[model samples]
Target: MKHLLFLYLGVVSSFASDTRPLKERVNEFCQKHRSIAEIEKRHAEWIKQEPDNPDAYILPANALAKAAETVNIVAGDQKDAIAVLTDPKTGKQVGSIAEGPDPAIIKRAEDILKAATKKFPQRLDIHVGRMAMSQRIKDTEAVTTAALDLLATAAKDPQTLRWIDNEQIDGVPLKKALEEVEARIRWLYSFEKDETDKFAQDCALKALELAPGNVELLNFAAIRHLYRGEWKEGREYLLRAEIAAPRDWIVQHNIARASAELGDKADALKRLQAVIKAVPGTDDAKAAEASIKSLGLDVPK
Candidate 1:
């Protein structure tokens, strides 16, 4: 019996570790505008491989839900719609006998949180996840209301404080207070001094803890790192942000600068060539092409 129990535990542990890279790869693919078919395949594989992971189910559902925008409204084909999810890749249909929305991801992230809350009633992340979704929808009333509810609940549990305060992935404890989030916003208001940039920098870092792999947050962090001449850290995050938001010209240049800083001339030239090739006729593109020329590169025609 002891050996059997140990084997079971080992299997569970290995399964959990394996899922980490799968999630990261999904996030990376999303950033790079990978095809729905690809993400869908991987997502489908994840649910199959780790059927018990509620979060894995949620990831694919959320991805399709947002892009497909399956809202509270249902179509006349409701029975069939719920019967099988329309495959985002091949435009085919897949039916899972699980019943309900083919990928009843979450009608809203709140649903996921509610489920999470039941399991971890004490977990502040469950509350924050819901609140974060509320903010995404620009539901100010909802954000304020839900945040208040969480603030009250977290007050009774010091463990929840880091969730809002500290800047860590998988979420912070309730780290600081709602006041801190607000204060960061307030600081964004017409303060002409350099201090605004500092607060934005601080808030950007804080945002990453809550929403890891966020391109906007990564860009902000990269800018701060650039200002401080922290080339290595700045370059790594910029590369990630580049994958996330390729159209951002600033990110393109940052990649070049990072490569130059690292003395990787080949990589620097190649990226610069890509940027210039992406927009050949523009004055800005021309200037970038010149920068590549300065690198002694043979510009790709």
Candidate 2:
């Protein structure tokens, strides 16, 4: 999944001068993939090659945002990012955008975004990143405002409405792309507070409805159940997800979590231990350790 994400992000650089695809790909990667390093390297080279271009910031920052996941910390270069897109004097970033649970990254991203927005006030990605960052910092009003703004914009551009005639709707075109964007954004907020609401469930459901038997939707639905503390249901969903996404660490992590919550601590611990052994310094491993500690389970360190 991570590799495919990096690949998709390669296609979204808006090397074409548009924020829509780049914004969508970055958000999708953050929520679903485990690493963005490949794309980050690509973006770094892109920036190095085009030092004076404002457009470079969008993909480069997004690349960093994705790479942040791999390091178990927000390991992105926001200053390099904003310096490209930001107007400096006003302190808002435009075009470039990202999401984070890490404060340092969020602050850096927001500062840059503030600079960029001055130059491109109507760019939705800047507002989305700001709102997501504000929520992480616990600025309630800002979160609410961002959500309201996003919802307002989203209302006008429903997945149903973003389609255009003669735009090649089949084999990955406008309609499918728009739906994926909306679904990812909806669940990102739903899962951010470590809880899954009905709205998030709806998004997952819609995804499944769109592509029945899709392992991706199955995995997302499983996580939603996990977030809501529905252990048994979460486990059942995850069992299917694990089958569908055998190599995905995120799914593996959720399986461990649900197993622990359901009192299958031995299985959970084993899975956690195996993942950490396989991928050192991963958030999946950290989360597994946290779960083990919380459950009074012991594992060899």
Off by over 4 Å in 2: 1-165, 169-188, 191-196
Structural similarity to truth (TM-score) of each candidate: 0.36, 0.42
Q: Which digits, one per residue and each the tens of the lDDT, describe model 2 over residues 233-269?
A: 9788777877767767777777887888888988988
TM-score of 1: 0.36
Model 1: residue 137 alpha-carbon error in angstroms = 30
Could you tell me the lDDT of residue 60 within candidate 2? 45
Q: Given candidate 2, what's the lDDT at residue 215?
A: 65
Candidate 1, 48-159: lDDT as tens digits? 7775544443344344434433333332244424354566998765443222222232234345444444444444444555555443434444444445455455556645
Task: Please report, in order, the local distance difference test score of every candidate based on alpha carbons.
Answer: 0.52, 0.52
In lDDT terms, how accurate is model 2?
A: 0.52
Highest TM-score among the candidates is held by which one?
2
The C-alpha local distance difference test score for the whole of candidate 1 amounts to: 0.52
